[model samples]
Target: MPAPTEMPTKHSTPYPTWEQFQQMEKRQDALEKRQDTTDRRLDSGAGEFAEIKKAQDTLRQQQAAHGQTVAEVREILAELRELVESFGNLKGTIRVMRIAGDVIRWGCTLGAAALGLWVAFRSLGGGL
Candidate 1:
């Protein structure tokens, strides 16, 4: 009987040669270098992002403090408005008091003059 022939495989080469293996190693090294560069860039970007977040937090705190200060200022303004209104009312009251004082002084002066006239006439015997 004849010896059995070997069956043909799908690919032409069964395994990679020395030069092909060397080329694959070089490609893998390049890929690793690129990955390292990407990792370093991502790390630096993360630090920048953290710094930006911290700054935003500080700004928010400052804004809150300013809001409280504004509220306090508004309260002070309201109190000042009430004080001014009270002063205006006091001015009107003082005017009314001054007018009343003038009227009382005039009434007293007229009464005293009339009494003096009556006494003089009685002493002079002017009545029949």
Candidate 2:
């Protein structure tokens, strides 16, 4: 009987063709390019986000300033109201003074008329 043919053992390393090696190199280069583009996009987006945050901060500061202005206006209004009230009181005081002056003038006129009548009656020989 013939001896059984032995099957060849499989080789440890498979030889890659030159075309396969070039294809792998190209794929690696494309992957590196994609990564670089992604990094640049992330950097640009971060810069834009920072600008937006700065704008938001500025807006908040402006709002705070506006609030302060409103508060100051309210204080000024209160002061104006106080001044108006004092002015009203002064007007009332002036009105009372005018009335009192009129009363005094009337009293003086009546006293003078009575004195004149008395003097005339004495001159005419009438008893006091």
Candidate 3:
């Protein structure tokens, strides 16, 4: 078998010489430091994300409570509507009863007047 002229790599090699290899190492070290910094930032961001999630949950609970309050208000309004209708009906009944009482009072007064007139005519010797 013939000796291969170059080494094979899994990835394309941009650094084929000694100086290029040294430069590649420097770039790799820089990239590793940047990646560490990024990881630290992400760790701190996770705490913020947790707080955001908690706030969202609280907001959802408050919304549900407000919905219950609205439902209760609607129920109260319906009850009030019924009460108002009952009150109006009672007013009409009172008016009818008052008119009937007036009629009865006037009828009694007129009857008493007619009886007194008849008694006076009888005492004056009028026909029975």
Q: What are the TM-scores, per candidate, against the unseen true structure?
A: 0.69, 0.65, 0.68
- Residue 125 in model 2: lDDT: 96
Runs with alpha carbons beyond 4 Å of true place in candidate 2: 1-16, 115-128
The worst-scoring run of ten residues by lDDT in candidate 2 lies at 1-10
What would the per-residue lDDT of candidate 2 be over residues 16-111, giving only the tens digit for each residue?
A: 557778999999999999999999999999999999999999999999999999999999999999999999999999999999999989988998
Please give the range of 10 consecutive residues that has the lowest summed lDDT in model 1: 1-10
Q: Mind giving the per-residue lDDT tens digits that candidate 3 earns over 27-79?
A: 99999999999999999899899999999999999999999999999999999
lDDT of each: 0.90, 0.89, 0.91
Alpha carbon lDDT of residue 87, candidate 1? Answer: 99
20: Cα error in model 2, Å: 3.4
22 in model 2: Cα distance from truth in Å? 3.2
| Candidate 1 clashes between residue pairs 3 or more apart in a chain or in different chains | none
